[model samples]
Target: MRDRIEKRMAEIAVIGLGYIGLPTAIMFANAGFNVTGYEIRKDVVERINSGKAHIVEPDIDDLLRKVIESGKLRATSNPADIREKDVYIICVQTPLREDRTPNLTYLESAVETVAKAMKPGALIVIESTIPPLTTVRMAEFIEELTGLKPGRDFYMVHAPERVMPGRIFRELVYNSRILGGITPESAEIAERLYRSFVKGQVFRTKSTVSEVVKLMENTFRDVNIALANEFAYLAHQYGINVFEAIELANSHPRVKIHVPGIGVGGHCLPKDPHLLVWPARDDFGLIRLAREINDGMPLLAKDLLFEALRTINLPPEKAVVAVLGLAYKGDSDDTRNSPASAFVEAIVDDVAEVRTYDPFVEGTHGSLEEALRGADAVVIATDHTVFRSLDWETLGKLMRNRVLIDGRHVVEMPPEGFVFKGVGRGEY
Candidate 1:
């Protein structure tokens, strides 16, 4: 198996070709592997096969086009297209339920599909972030379905992907990977396969430890961000800019502070902390409280908007709000578990009208000027690079009222003649 992987002779099947899966398939294909991408979404499959990507990410279009045109990669919705592959990499999402429980249905379904289609000696890899012990449980489930004993007749490994959305392709090549195998041989084979394209460091360990490490990485950030958000709340009370305070505190060299924002967003930070504590027998109060603090940040942004509205003597029902960006992060269109969506949902019923404009996201206003044309207030959600250099003084002429709310701290200075309120900017 190692020799086949090193020579790029192993046929690879990547299941769930969404954000992670498609890029992964492209990387392997670009690395000289014959890769077939299996996605349940027919539209995504058609798009990929046509050398286009469904999601927006840097360098995805050109790289996907390169692999697709080279005939090294193809995407299919049909299960038969992926049958009896030497390698199966599952990159499905393991989201959280409404009550903050880990939802493993997608992971289980992908594993079941791989079990039904895999050969005896095939190597199976799961790149999804999941609860601890899930890979072990999944190996047993596959054994029950396929009657093939794990580590003997087959090999299984939990290889979690650790890349951000905007820099996915670059990070895929540079980010260090952790391969947690159910057995020692499983980790070794998966490491060799990834080393075909990965230039970063690779480490092997037990499946459960890797799972805990992935979750802990996100949980640590979530907790630190929650601390920063708490400082923002304190800044509101003290009337001092938390950003400046954080900057001054960091001068001490031991006081590194995470930037406080409207909310934590994207797929990982909000959900992984919940998944980390979901299966534990003991209560994890700090982890759960961090999630709660981060989740409530949107409401804090809403409060700032309302305070600005009150200062302008505009009623909430009569105000027209324009939300600048909808995606979870800057320069990417992936909105899974986005705090911008949460903020919009929180104020949708109260506001008279809400206009959204994101350059990368569809189903919003055609242009930023169109969204702000008669709107009373403009709220900057995602801090896209374009927002940093916006000519706010010129654009303010299009508004009914020049009320600016900076949720993501895009505006460093308050433009003249506008009522500006920003998260962590204590002067309201």
Candidate 2:
């Protein structure tokens, strides 16, 4: 069945070639599908046409280059080329608004574009994460625009892209896939499209269930981190070691707690929580207390930093604060909704002369030594690997003071004068 479907879907049109889209396009092309990567950005379209990728994803550059060379992949700002493809995958952005509401503008626009050009019996897959109702509504819109009932004339499915930004290439083909279609036929077609390349299991369900599953996956991580962050705060107050506590707790068969940190950040984690909260209050007549708890974390980290400075008899505004790591996570340069960025920006705005160092971000500071120079205090907000490898003796010498706030519990200290603080590690 899968092989027969693969023979049917010879061409795939991937819309909105951002981080997820480009990589998906390349993966499909490498799997021998004729892949057309569509983007409205002229520069991006031209870059891919010239066998280059604008977005930074692992192995995508080489794969795109190869597939393009093999006449299996192409890119364009135009949709006429896109209309000819049998499979359409939407991978646009679904961000939160300034008011913290789920913003679906990019997604709606993608749907409008795809609806206008898609042919009969074509399979449409939405890989962008969205609120549960989004896929069903998009399917309705496609029916409305294409003048064809979803199950009969065309098929649509939601296979929310589960690929992490840094690990996109491997996860695209290796991680498990979910298929939620407007109809069972749509789901079956979507499953075949995925099975052509995906070695991972493709579970089948309805569109709304798949939508919530994607959001739930990210929200679960956010909620876990929130617990970790709260414990980190409590540990700071009690002078306990959180890393030790977490390690001890993990000894239990089912007590798998997350590591404490300054705050939770990243495009998905920060945004998905809000999506659930807004629809709960507005659409579903429910309150979002847990969401608020997680959302309050960045502020809590900031307030803790001020209290830490006070303990050392330093005014936060007067202290030269150094921030270690600006990316949301270690070993990657993506800063979209980075928790560290939020924390540092708050510190910069509220009360501090903040300097930041990230090995991934070149030219921000020539070296970690340069970023931490003359600091009255160092706030290890992001757990980049280089921060862990820092020579503590050299750090002590370079700093104007010795108060080290290990927001991520990544620092090792000297016994004499250094004080370290991490969530739940209430001892340092």
Candidate 3:
């Protein structure tokens, strides 16, 4: 088993080169292991092969270049090319259905693809963030397809990924990992491999528990954000700055609270909590309460802007609102579930025009200059680092009007004059 694992590590095949897969592949290569990134997108395959990253994760391009230069990393779209490896990790998308059901078609296809090429015994670890029963269900399908039993004919394990898009590499190596397998021995076997790269604890459990762990972690975040957002909404009614009150509460030394943004947005926090909504709907009704509060926050943010505009004596139809930041959060270009998008869509029904600017975004309103040009009010939906460092002097030259709506509370110096407002902070 040790010899077999050594050969597998010497040449590992990473299936589905996505945001999760690419970082995993790069890390394996960074550790001096040979890694083949198998992506379905021909363009993405070519890009990685040439040491260029499609996604904007910190230092990934540099790592990709280093690994490719060392001849330890490569990418290919052809299944025939992917057939020569031992370990295959499925990292394709697992988006939700219209009714918030977990869609596993991508996982199913990748399992079939690997099962066809995979030989007698190769370790297959699933690293997708899926709900309970996903790993077991996929394992059963793979057994039927390959005529192999888990931990006997081959090893099957589920190690759900706990990576933030911007901090993928650092977190993947340093954060605690939860490993689960069909059998006890299978869990041990998988834990040994992961322990090599991860500096943090390697926890072992059943496949179902491992799946649930990811959901629990992300859903907890969503719940906390919702709590903050709910308070922000209530505070608005009383003309109180929620952030100022939160700071006072934090002075108690027992409370550490998350800051309120326009809304909770991200691939994980916005959607993963709902992955279990269908299964636990009957017993766990409070989950629905959390989801409702969070999902409704974007609309609330829009309404707040409209109300603020009205206080200044401007109708929604006559206002020209500009948004700052489209990425889900600060410092990253990944916008899988950005709340700002929803905020724009919500009030656009009545507004004259809505412009947005994110330095991380490649196109659209493209630059900060466009965001401030001919604007009745500017709304800071996300708390990107660049927005915090904006020069008021430069913006003052480009501005058509003032009225800054700064959410996320990251801006230290509120956009000078022009009426600054945030979700939690009443006004400045």
Candidate 4:
């Protein structure tokens, strides 16, 4: 199996061609493997086959086109097209339920598909972030469906992806990977497979530890951001700039403070913490409280927007609010678990009108001018790089009322003649 993988003779199947799956397939294909991508969305399959990327990421289009033109990658909607592949990499989403439990439906369905299609000696790799013990349970589930004993008839490994959305292609190559196996051989085989393209250090451990490590990494960030948000609230009370305070505090050798924002967003930070604590019997309130703090940040943004309107003597129902940036973060099209969406939801019912403009996201207002024209207030949500250099003095002329609310701290200075209220800029 190692020889076939090293020789690029192992045919690879990547299931679920979303943000993670498509890029993963492209990487493997560009590494000289014959890769097949399976996605239920026919439109996505058609788009990929034609060398176009549905998601926005740096260098994805050029990389995807290279592999597609070389005949190394082919995307398909049919299950038969992926049958009997030597490698199966599942990159499906494991979103949280409405009640905050880890929803494993997508992951399970992908596993069932692989179980039905995989041969006896195929290597199964799950790149989805999931609850601890899920990989072991999944191997048992596959055994029930395929009657193939794991680590005997087949090998299984939990190799969670550790890349951010904007820097996915670059990070996929540079980021250190953690491969957790149910057995020693499973980890060894998966490491060999990824080392073909991965240039960063690779670590091997048990499946459960790998799961905890991924969740812990994100959870740590979430918790620290929550602490930063608390500091933002304190700044509002103390009538100071949290950013300035954080800068000075971070000057201390041991102090490293995270910047406050509207909320934590993206796929991992918001959801992985919940998945980490969901399966545990009992957890101290710290993790859950941190999640609540982060979740409530959008509401804080809403409050700031409404307060700006009140200061301008405008009622909430009469305000035409324009929200700039809808994606979770800057320079990316992904909106899963985005705090911007939550902030919009919080204000959509109260505000007279809400206009959204995100350059990378589709189905938004065509231009920033269009969204701000005649709007009573403008809220900066995503902190896109372009937003940093915006000529606010000129853009303010387009608004009906010059009310600027910086939800993500995009505006460093308050423009003259505008009622500005930023998340941690209490001096405004």
Q: After superposition, how far is residue 417 of candidate 3 from its true place, in Å?
A: 3.7
Candidate 2 global lDDT:
0.78
Tell me the deviation in Å of residue 119 in model 3. 1.3
lDDT head-to-head 1 vs 2, winner? 1
Model 2 agreement with the true structure over 1-428: per-residue lDDT tens digits: 24536674467889998888888888888777888888989998889988888866667778888988998888888878888468889999899888888889999898888888887878889999888777888888888887878788888899988888778888888999889888898898788778778999889999988988888888788777777767776776777777888899999999999876767677788888667555554543222444555556667667767777888898887888777887877777777877777777777866658888877765467677886778887777777777777777777788887667776667655335655555455665
lDDT against the true structure, each candidate: 0.93, 0.78, 0.80, 0.93
Give lDDT tens digits, candidate 4, residues 1-428.
99999999999999999889999999999899999999999999999999999888889899999999999999999999999999999999898889989899999999999999999999999999999999999999999999999999999999999998888888999999999999999999999999989999999999999999999999999999999999999999999999999999999999999989999888789899999988889985999999999999999889888888989899999999999999888887888888989999999999899999999889999999999999999998998899999998889899999999998887888999899999988875
Lowest summed-lDDT stretch of 10 residues in model 4?
Answer: 328-337
Q: What is candidate 3's lDDT per residue for 213-303, written digit by digit as tens?
A: 8889888888887888888877877888888878898898788777777787777787788775545536566676888888787776676
Q: Where is model 4 more than 4 Å wrong at Cα? A: none
> Any runs in candidate 1 off by more than 4 Å, and if so which?
none
